[model samples]
Target: MCGIVGAVAQRNITPILIEGLLRLEYRGYDSAGVAVLAEGNGIQRVRAVGKVIELQNALQATPATGHLGIAHTRWATHGKPAEHNAHPHMSGKLAIVHNGIIENHSPLRKKLIELGYQFTSETDTEVVAHLIAHYYSESHDLLDAFRTALGELHGAYALALMHEDQPETLYCARMGSPLVIGQGSDEHYIGSDPLALLQVTDRFRYLEEGDHARLTINTCEIWDRDNLSVDRPLTRYEHAAHSLEKGEYRHYMLKEIFEQPQAIRDTLAGIVGDDHVLTAILGPDAETRLVDIANIHIVACGTSYHAGLVARYWIEDQAGIPCTVEVASEYRYRTVVVPDNTLLITISQSGETADTLAALRFAKDQGYLATLAICNVAGSSLVREADWRLLTHAGPEIGVASTKAFTTQLVALLWLTTALAQVRGKPADQIAANVKALKDLPAIIEQALTLEPRITTLAERFANKHHALFLGRGTHYPIAMEGALKLKEISYIHAEAYAAGELKHGPLALVDEDMPVVSVAPSDALLEKLKSNLEEVRARGGQLITFACETIDQTNDSNHEIINLPFVEGCISPILYTIPLQLLSYHVALVKGTDVDKPRNLAKSVTVE
Candidate 1:
């Protein structure tokens, strides 16, 4: 999980490269560096140990002017976060910035050492620079050198290379990681994501797997796996400018939290209409294929995996389908049984999550009936590789601790469940009722946002607690897990979640007055049983913070605090309940004085294994 950007422009491109790196800092911030091919000098490089601002300050002290440059903000996969391991690794004739892991670097390093090459950094990226330099020494062609270096490399990577001999051109390659080429009037840009290039141009071309490109000032030439020239169509993204701004909010995380209403509405716009009618967005043949599906296998990672867990409940309850949710990293490494007519569904916010992408490819090889990707990005690898796709219109989620992306993914999963239910011959009235409940989500979420003041006060109680426990049951059990994840992610607190009933088995022993217990007590059939579980916690003198619907009875006990949420009918409780939990984590992180947006030791996207 790192950010890489390269630009070839007619004018000096140092500022553009720096700005792009600043925008992409959320992806990674352990270390930062930039390599430029100066007009007179062969190559000038600047590196820093932490943050883009450090790199910016270093650049100010020693300025480097160039028409072409490549920059990187690293997440420290191969080495510790240090200046020596920072990216834009240089090797005399060539410099490179790389994202993703080089699994074969150890063997390659041994071979390079045998050839009398010396390394200055502990990063696998340095091996790439030296390899490219060695290849360029042979052919003297930058493009051929890149191709040769790529052939010798193993594992996922998105690389941008610049040669001292070819100062006006940039060579790039992608395999299993994201790389996009932005088209501009007098310049061309390469970035890990489209947001990095939005300041310069909204038009971009997404490079497919095993694609290499050579970019000049105004032209870009793409080569496929066979080394044959290919043309990638340009797409003009409309909302890039607006999505990049924080608007009136103080932080991008808060702005994104408030944007959930619009995000959910945008995701639902074309799929649902008046009178609770559902239109088809999954293509015309989806209904036919869905009806024949016997099972659903959902593979995802992190927050996306929690969303999949919630979807399992919905799909099984609503559509009567046997659904299995697996962590993508675990699923790819194991032998899974795929029965006939099984549907493989992959969920990811970036769609470039390495494990999820690998899991999807594995499922493709198993001959599934159809593959579906529920993701936010339009042209990401998951979307392109899958046979069916649904987009979560959450825009750019800059926060390392995900907020809007998880909620919007829940919304998308709900839609998928409802659609599958209808295709499987569920009653028309029942489907309409579910649609109506879905329609009320935006307003319900808006009401949930108003609970910030209440959640903030709750946060004050949580600030001092070193450990906490979250409890929920039934469909909302996964929501409890998500809440715990959010709390630990931003607040740096130790938190664990359990399915309430399991508390008596082991987690109950950890509950005490000092250990705060947060319970998700929605007004559902399980609410009564959940009340008994709360009593179990209270018996142990544990402090309780409960989120319940307005209809639920308020506890008179002083040790317990109750948060009355807005009444939401049907199975949409998970979506509405997530808002206050997010606010709670945000406020708790604020109280604890931790970095809310970029949490320590975490990256926004997990593009590497």
Candidate 2:
């Protein structure tokens, strides 16, 4: 994800702009830049190839001061992570910062080159500056030029622009990307995330799709999608800004991992009971929609997709409905066949994930009974667009690898499973058992975290290992995939996960004394099959580490190490098994000396395709 922040204020706003960029550093970026309309310096800019701190250092060396400015943390979508390719891409007297892909930039750049516009950087964002500036030259009105330029754009973007002539105003626009306005005393700000502006102002207004605005010290005029002036409702953000800090933890990833128990407890606080899950947790009319009998379709990306995969098992086994999960990017690009009463569900942590949002938009036209958004951000575009929503109350997940968020999403999915089970005439005894397990989830996860010291010792063995295999059966298969993903993401280790049954088919050949294999052996019906698979690995001299049910008779030998998990049944087992896997990755990444919070080449929120 890319970060964008802009401000027009009464005092020199350089401090405000840089502070916003500092807060947005967690989104992950390889380059940073800022542009300010200096008194006589006509849109001065400072750029750096790596880290927002480098940009801050350069800004201190060569001060770029103005009452108005724009700053960005670029994640390298259209160009390399070079100073020239950093954001605040300028053309003539105009400078702009952008966050999303420009699909038509190639053709637009060609047209501008033929029109005598010289390109200085290999960025699609620069093409946008030239396009806007070219229009500005003719219209002489910034908004008019912006309006004309917006007509030709063919992709997602959240833009902040400043022209030399518009010294007192900042131009902003949002299309398919997230942008919010921060209101303050005689000053206004725009940030891609509300957290970025918390230091200056908590009062914010989320820009709707196709919303464009011109901001000055005392005014923020927003145009609706229909080009008519409108007022978006204001939100006074109350979530603690201090939650972003790591506190006593060595890394944010560790802090988030330890926070999982509380996160799961919060997620199940009101929705679960002693014996059954409240169906109304989906919505007041949830059962009204659930009564319609058919299968379900789940769409998501990355970690969210793994949550969907786990949900397929619960929804199918408990609710007796066919659940199909698809990656949102691929799902959006193809023709989908929706069966009757097929409810479309999209999972996202940010809820601003570009492809997931696009897929949700596409699913709307597919004749689904209703749309449900399993999201973290209550105000995100996905929640607003969906017919129903179930928030994964995992709080703020600053880590790029996603620890608490993934588990909380599973908790939310369990809630959905019980709701569907009740309405679909599933066994009352089974529904009660599922809910009873969920109620004990917080304590189970807390016990699971106790294995951290043991996992830390086990992770040391993996620090030097280059390749590993993960094996699981049934719902735990997705948990194994998630474990593999977490390892690859933060540890930079090459890991592959497979269904335990698929061992003889291919993955077993790569196993040897040097190859470390991680397995999730829950005491489900597939335990016998998983045991046979583990025997295959042991016979091949594969180094083995397993998170197992305590009931499984196991002894740690030279090749096998077992970390016992608190036993649980039904839908809650996968959620419990996920805890040890998370700690394993965290400690492995710790041993590998990688940036656990913001891993290389990854962002916490994937706001762009």
Candidate 3:
């Protein structure tokens, strides 16, 4: 998860590059750097170990102004977060910024070392700069050298390179990672995201896998993986800058949390029609695909994986089709026994998650019925490559800790469940009833948002908590997992989630007076079973914090605290309960004085493995 921004223009690109880097701050980074073709000279670069402001301050002190440049905000991989490992790594006249990992860098670094190349940083990216520079030494053509260098590299990458000799041109390439070219009058740009280049250009072109381009101020020359020149479509893209602003909220996390009501409404708007679920929103082949579906193989990472886990319960309970959910990172390594007519589903907010995208590719050949990408970004590699795509309208999830994306995904999955159930012989009225329930979800979640003040007070107790245990039953188990993930991600608490039944087997041992045990007590079939597990935590003298339904008769005692939420029907309970957990994490992070929007050691869109 790194960011890349490049520009080839006749004007001062310094301010533009710095602002682009600032726009990419949401993606998360430990080190930042910029490489520019110096004013009437060779290449110049500035790198900083901390925030982008440090790089900005460094630039203000000693500017590297040029018309052609590439900037990067790196989320460390292959090396620690340090100025030495920062991007804009150089080799003589060539300066390069890269996002994604180079798997064969170890061997490449060794080979380059023997060829009279001296390494300065312990980064795999430095090898790319040296490799390109090595080839440039022989060919004297920068594009030819870049293509040759790309051919030698293994694994995913989105690279932007600049040559001192080619002052007016910017070289960029994408292989299993996202890269976009911005079209402008007498100027062009390349960025990992369209949002970063919005100030300069409205029209953008997305590069597919193995596509490379040479960009001049007025021209964008492209080539496919076969060294064939190709032209990618240029389409106008527009986003209001104020839409990204936090406004009244202190952090993007808080903004997105409140945005969930509208976000879910938007996600369902395309699919939920008058008393019926619109199956066509999924794709032309969705109904036909569901007809033969005997199983589902859901693969994703992080919060998306947890979303899949929740969908597993829905698919089985509603459609009567067995579903298995696995973390995308581990799915490819194991020998997967895919059943006949098994549908492979991959979920991601950005749709550019490296492991999930790679797993989707691997699953394509494993004899699945079809692959569907439930993604947010329409231009993401996963959406472009998948057989069928369901776009989640979460807008832009700028916060590293996802809120709206997760709920919007749940909404998408619920609609998908209805579509699947329809073809699988579920009652039409029952399906319609479930879809009808979704229409009220926005209001229900809005009511849940009203419980934030209670959550804020509950979160104060967690400011001193270093460890937390989250427990849930049935579909809520995944909700528990997601809540734990949020708490750990933002609040920096050591949080773990276990199925309520599994608590006594091992986790109950960790429960004590100092330990906080949190649970979402939904009024479902498992409520009685979940209460027994809660008793186990209470027996262990743990601090019990329950986000229970208003219908449940509960009182706060010395050892326990209960925040009653607006009761909802069983079908949409998970979505409703999720809000309080999010608020809990946010308020807890605020109390702990932690960075709520941009968390440490994490990136919003995990674009690399």
Candidate 4:
């Protein structure tokens, strides 16, 4: 995903746009560009490969000024990262900056070529600009021309356009990617990220699918697909004001990690109380039906999948239901035998994730008895499709790494387990005690974040390792997989996760003293079995970093170090155990001097297939 922003301001817009680009750079860093409509002049454009600083320096070399403008920090899906491929792609009269892929770009390019439009760069975005220019020649107005061209386009996109013919206004539209309109004094802005508008304004309207906005210096008009003008409500963003400040922390990642305490407290407030956990959606037969189900099929993408993995153990042990977890993409392609009375649970931070949403639709089509979704967004598509829903009060998770959302999902899933146990007629004392544990999770998580120093130190040991393995069993297996994914994505480390029991099958052959193995060996029933597995690694001379519930006194046999974790009940251990692993991967990436937040070639949302 790339970042796109546009501003029509009473004052000079270059600085505002540039500042906005800086905030949105986490979305992409391949290249940066800006196009502004100059007074009594045509569109002035500047672009360069690399970060915003490079574009800033390029702009300094040859400056462009205008009050109405659009800018993009590109992630380069369609072409290489070069000046020619950089965004703010321009035609004779139109300039366009786009995010998301145009899947039919080849056919669109061919049609435009046949229509006598010359293309300058190898980009799907360039095709859009040319298409607009082609139509503007006929319509004589930018907005009407834009509507005509967009009618032919396909795939996910959030586009912002500035035209020489319509220099006073910037037009924006969204299909799947995030776009927000910020209201300002004598100005109006559209940005892919809310952080771009944080300094300029607090009030913002989140543009929905098929919505378009025309922004002028003093006015903004939003329009739907049918050409009817509409007004979307604006909400005051909570993090808008405090966003720019590093405040009491050194980096946003660390600040967000520490903010988990407050995040948990905020998420748990009102949702759980008086020794009873609650879901945003609850029914009398809901818990009983879920527990009575023959099987569960949990589907999600990225960090949400990790949460599902944790839930698998809870559902299996506590609710006595068989559970299977799948990556939504693969799940969609596979021929799934939907067992009758199966509950298909789809989890997503943003319920609009292309693959996850498709998976939910597929599950419904196959006639699964009940489909439930755990998500953060209120009216997201998955919520509409599911028979039941649980909302994690994680607010908006702006960062791509997904800190707060993952924790809140864990809270919700753990609550689901307790509720299922209760409805299945579990003893009162057991249900009450488990509810008490769930209530105390926020405090326990706060205590966990204090392990920052320990995690940081552990990170140093593995920072230089080229290859690694994350091993776990049962609930911890998915956590191991998540940790490996994070390590590989952020640190550029070659890592794989495997169940500890499955290690000897093939993965163990790659292990040696030079390679590090991070083990998730919590104090569960399989702890002794996991201990013997760790011994196998030691016998093979593999360096070890073990995360366990208790301290290991015998640390001499190829064991590197042990990070003690909070000992909780087996049902809820995955939630608490995940904290250290997340911190460990985060710190390792930090120590390796990698871009922990944006990680190369990764976007916060997968809007396009």
Q: Give candidate 4's error at residue 472 in angstroms.
A: 1.2
lDDT of 3 by residue, 1-609 (tens): 478999989888988898898887765567899988886767888999988899999998878988999999986655677889998999998899987667678899999999999999988899999999999999998888999999998766889999888889899998756789998889999998887998888899989778999999898899999999898998887344338787777888998999898777656643554455655444434567678889999999999999999999999999999999999999988899999999899999998898999999999889998889998876678886887777676878899999999999999999888888887778878887897789889998988899888888888898788999999999999999999999999999999999999986899889999999999998888888888889888987999999998888779999989888877777789988899999999999999999888899999888888
Write model 4 residue lDDT over 161-277, tens digit each, in one string: 887767788899987466899999888999887778787998899887789888887888899878788989989987632464556665555666666665555444433434544
Candidate 4: regions farther than 4 A off: 1-246, 283-294, 551-559
Candidate 3 vs candidate 4: which has greater lDDT?
A: 3
Q: Kindly report which residue pairs in candidate 3 clash with one another.
A: none
TM-score of each: 0.62, 0.62, 0.62, 0.59
lDDT against the true structure, per candidate, is 0.86, 0.86, 0.86, 0.79
If the candidates were sorted by their lDDT against the true structure, best first, what order would they fall in? 3, 2, 1, 4
lDDT string for model 2 (81-175, tens) is 68989989888888999977666788999999999999888888899999999998998988999988988887667899988887899989987
Model 1 residue 575 lDDT score: 87
Give the deviation of candidate 3 from the true structure as CA RMSD.
Answer: 16.6
lDDT, residue 528, candidate 1: 90
Residue pairs clashing in model 1 are none
What is the per-residue lDDT of model 1 for residues 1-609, given as tens digits with 9 covering 90 to 100?
478889999888899899999887644356889988898888899999887899999999999879999999986556677888888898986789987666678899999999999988877889998998888888987788788889988766789998878878889998756789999998999998778888899999989878999999978999998899999999897572356777667778898899889778656644553333332345444667778999999999999999999999999999999999999999999989999999999999999999999999988789799999999876588987888778786878898888889988998898888888887778988888888888789998998889898888889998689999999999889999999999999999999999999999999999999999998888999889999999999999999999999998776478999998988875899988888889998999999999888899998889999
